[model samples]
Target chain A: MKFIHTSDWHIGRQLHNQSLLEDQRHVLTQIVELAKSNEVDAVVIAGDIYDRSVPPANAVALLDEVVNQLVNELGIKVIMIAGNHDGHERLGFASRQMQQSGLYIIGPLTSHIEPIVLQGKQGGAAFYPLPYAEPATVRHLYDCAASTHEEAMIALLEAVTAHDSQGLPKVVIGHCFLDGGSESESERPLSIGGADKISPSLFKDFDYTALGHLHGPQYKGQEHTRYSGSILKYSFSEQKQKKSVTLVEFDADNKPQISLLPLTAMRDVRIVDGALDELLAAAENDANRDDYLMVRLSDKHAILDAMGKLRSVYPNVLHLERTGLMASNEQLGIRADHIKKGELEMFADFFSQVSGEPLTQAQQQMMVDTIDALHKSEDNQ
Target chain B: MKFIHTSDWHIGRQLHNQSLLEDQRHVLTQIVELAKSNEVDAVVIAGDIYDRSVPPANAVALLDEVVNQLVNELGIKVIMIAGNHDGHERLGFASRQMQQSGLYIIGPLTSHIEPIVLQGKQGGAAFYPLPYAEPATVRHLYDCAASTHEEAMIALLEAVTAHDSQGLPKVVIGHCFLDGGSESESERPLSIGGADKISPSLFKDFDYTALGHLHGPQYKGQEHTRYSGSILKYSFSEQKQKKSVTLVEFDADNKPQISLLPLTAMRDVRIVDGALDELLAAAENDANRDDYLMVRLSDKHAILDAMGKLRSVYPNVLHLERTGLMASNEQLGIRADHIKKGELEMFADFFSQVSGEPLTQAQQQMMVDTIDALHKSEDNQ
Candidate 1:
């Protein structure tokens, strides 16, 4: 059985307020072409189908068009799950009915999961998909006392294990932060700290595990478990990373072979660093001038309308900074980190700083609950 | 053949910033029960399934559940369309596949429409559903010269008339403001003025025209052509209106019979007029204290924390107005009207007030284009 493994499409993501829909559409078309050329029996998208709970209309249209081509035109099975960024209910719309058309979408954690089995000429594999779910939601659904992400995942995996009595080879699809997985600027943290990270050993009994959330494609400790990563460079920090999908094939003996299939972006995201004048000269001959760029000027003096000047040649320049002047200032880095931290984390840090005591686990849980309630109320409005 | 005709669900609508999901869910349940009890051959939901382009998660879940029950459980055919409030592409997701399950959803104004034919034991009707489309979109889609809603509707209805060569009775389902229809505060204006309203005579060829966008259930000089109104009282102005769905029965002679099937809201929206003291006294024995209320205080003097006090007794009181003090003031009415006008309308009014001349059609079109482009840019973010 051969399958294309990918995740974190983030269909409606934007970089520095610039829409990435065109970039996304370009990469997705390539993915569909790859699936057709490889003749993969199924495409497994682990999670994060969209950047936000409510995706824009054009994003929805793009997804519908791509999925229609893959499932209806190419006749390939699609297995997808909802990530933390997705509103599970909205993503799972008409999911049950769609299953008959070879598009399987799983959303919201429940007690019982019926494994989706894909059959190929060689053999078949049963897939157990676990979409991202909060520990509080896990407790409510399963009636389990899981106060942490690890505990919640364990409970979910236990259910999967019980349902693994089928004779076919088993593959687990999940969206989570593994214990040692690398973090990226674009990935939203599941929790305030390491409590959300789970050990990769939970999938030990499964033949393979396809993971998502991290933006770089890599494996944890084992080769059978891997993250195919995002389809595009979502942030400047991911500029150097090569985006790809994983092609997995199960042998007649149920052994797995994996390989990375590189994807070409419509316009690459790149960083250009030099003096303002030198960068402007370089842009004159740059073949990929339309690529999204982060220009770091090395000149010490302030350049008037630096961004406007750069954009004249490189129309897609998304960010500009004076690296030479700010490289020695550690405060800038601290402020960026502060901006990334959630309100709860910042409050926790303030409490520890002012009172010389960290909040207790119970106190942190209370705060999480209160903050979640507040957000829900605001969302209602 | 009998069918339940309804429209303007506004599933995620709010009343003065208060979430109406519970009320919507309750009313939708009643609608489903009504269909079941009537044993209608089909349920034709004209348009406006959602209140906004992007609905919240809970609203999506509710719509999913309701549609699932109607199509899968009850085995009834449900045909829906997108309204001005809906992002057509988003609303049309999985629509093609859903048609196999007897759920038909039409979105954007396309060049061609395949009429949905619902068959019953007694016979059937061919439904031509036209989802709301902006004049620009219509012009782009059909490559026509239509620059107004009336012209666009005429072009679309021409296509419907062309497809009506079939022997089945033609039923037109549309979402548009008809000429001479009473307006309501809740209905979002499709355009600046009467340019969005079309003549009712345009649907003269169809046996029955089930319309939407108006919040009052009424016929426009003809019983066969009618507005089903909204499912609930979306605004205080609709407090006196009785919301209902139109049930249309077609006989063997191709004639139509229309009846109104009323819906009951979980929490009624009401306005209470009296002094604060008297209102509180009356609330002691009020059976429906939790109903959404607008308190009009008649006290001549000031009442501190009036809203806070009324909320204690009438827990769902959403608004408190000092009608006693403002009774003699026409400025307040003028201010209310000013607030209701759109930016373009306000600008036009201001321009007219200062220059004593109305904006030329070309200039008005330019302002509309600029404003739309600005809004589109913001929405992309």
Candidate 2:
């Protein structure tokens, strides 16, 4: 059976105090379009549908509509689970009724050991939707059993296997930081206030593990266990990473074939560093200059006029920084411009009239000296 | 068509430091059960499905389950809209598809003035799922020359009437507060913060205004316009009020027959005040006394003995206060048990222990003498 796997939509979110609703919407529309075109059997959203446990109303509405479209319009069945960032009880509410419809939402905390059998035309498979379970909760829930985060997770899988009478292929959907998955700063911290760490080996029993929480389309290995990534880029750091949903095909034997569904953002993020003239020269011929640029110019002294100079070229530039360093002469093909006699003196004379904190004589000389150094560096290159 | 109307489910929420996930689950489940038993044609969640724009994954999962159940299991159609506390684009992601699956979710900023047509068992009605729109947005969306929240809302409805061809009865589900609906602190703040304060007359064009955002179940002078209130009270002050879902029966004229479906808390919350003895005297008789209790005792003379006295009866006593009068009045029964005594000794003992400065004997005597005089009045009362 072939199914599209997507996780971590994180709808209705904010970053840098600016709302990402528009951005999230832009991407989700694309995902739905992708799903429709792909013609997959069903969709499995592993976890983290929202950024926070208490999502805003609009976020809820967004999911409501999206699911409605998928189930009603597209005629797709969706199986979703709650994550650690979710309030388990809240997610499980009205689940019984929902399941009776084609929406298979698994939010059972204690019943994680049991699998929801997906009976289909091709064959059948059991889906175990494990929200988040803490070790303490497991011990209390399972008669004071020895419980660790990893152990509790394994214990639940064991339960799933125990109940696998139909012997169908099994899929486990979850939200966790595996023992080896790489994480960025934007991901939720799960150190448990310095208490526990989860091991990926705990999930060895399942034929496939569709993970959430991490916003990257990569894997601990190359197959079976993978992150579909968030619906949106979410942060400046993530601007360049390829975001994609995963499609997994599980055979009767539970072996799987996986493919990536690439998602591209409307804007590209590019960073550049150089001095005033050199930076301008490079950007002038640059193909993607209109991309959302994070230009980090290595111009000695502050560039108060930098924004204005760059804005005309890269109007959508989101950031500008002046880091002190020599421009890369080889990369820019910057030629040393000739300095006419007394040009510095003329410029200094003009500068004196612009404002009240006029540069001291020594400061004026420093400017000329800096220009000479720039010229000398260009000559060497 | 008789149906359950609920709104402002800020799932994945916290009230103060307390988690409301369990409460949300309990209440939402009750609403679904109520709808199933009553056999309503549809469930209208006016707006604010989540507390914040980014609901936690759990909230999303639960909502998916509940909504799925309402449609699939209970055979009830769910028609929802966006509210002020939402990011519309995200919530309405799959609205188009949801419509095909027998669920109608009106999300985001829409200029389509025509109300959604609902063919109920009792004939048909025009269901206008009006999302909350800002004045500027409304002007832009409908190209309506209107300003102010009320004007914008009215303009949208007028446009609805002008464009709608479904002439059966008409009902409008909206997120607005009338002049009379009391505001809960957890609600989006009033006009100053962009929360729309609109009169029910804007909805006079329709049979029923199923409102959201306000956390109280109420109806304005127009019997047809009702606020379903929030699914759960989100603050300490809301403890006294019962949270409920409104049931509305719409006729051919689109007028409503409204009733409140009372919701009970899984755990009871109570605040009690008294001296140690009076509190313990009542605790033994209180049925749910062992439930979560916030005890405030006005006891005099450091009641070091109080914790030991109360711990036996109350398992989760969060707050404890000690006032001088209460500690001194730990007598059995006979409230206002006037015979006051030993004020000077109590004052002398307390001051002697707490103060850093070595107070003189005369000073201590003066302080005690003052307290004794105050106790004299209590002795009489």
Candidate number with greatest lDDT = 1
Q: Write the per-residue lDDT of candidate 2 for residues A1-381, one digit (tens) a residue.
A: 678889878776665455566667767777788778877667898787777655566666667767777776787778888765554554554555555456766654773355677765576677777776666667677655644566666666667667754667778888777767665435654432223456766666678888888887777743677788877666566766788889887776768889888876655545666777786777778777766667777777766678898877766566766556435554333221212124465466567767656678788768756865653343222
Q: For model 2, how does the per-residue alpha-carbon lDDT over B21-121 read when each residue is reduced to its tens digit?
A: 77788888999999988878888898888766555566666787788778876778888888876656556654554454667766676767546776667
lDDT of 2 at A74: 82
Q: List the residue pairs that clash in candidate 1.
A: none
TM-score of only chain B in every candidate structure: 0.94, 0.76
Best by DockQ, which number? 1
Best by TM-score: 1
DockQ of each two-chain model: 0.43, 0.12
Mark the regions of model 1 whose C-alpha exceeds 4 Å error after superposition. Answer: A272-286, A295-315, A320-381, B274-286, B297-313, B327-381
Tens digits of per-residue lDDT for model 1, B260-305: 9999988999989999999999999999999999888899998899
My TM-score estimates for the predictions, one after another, are: 0.89, 0.58
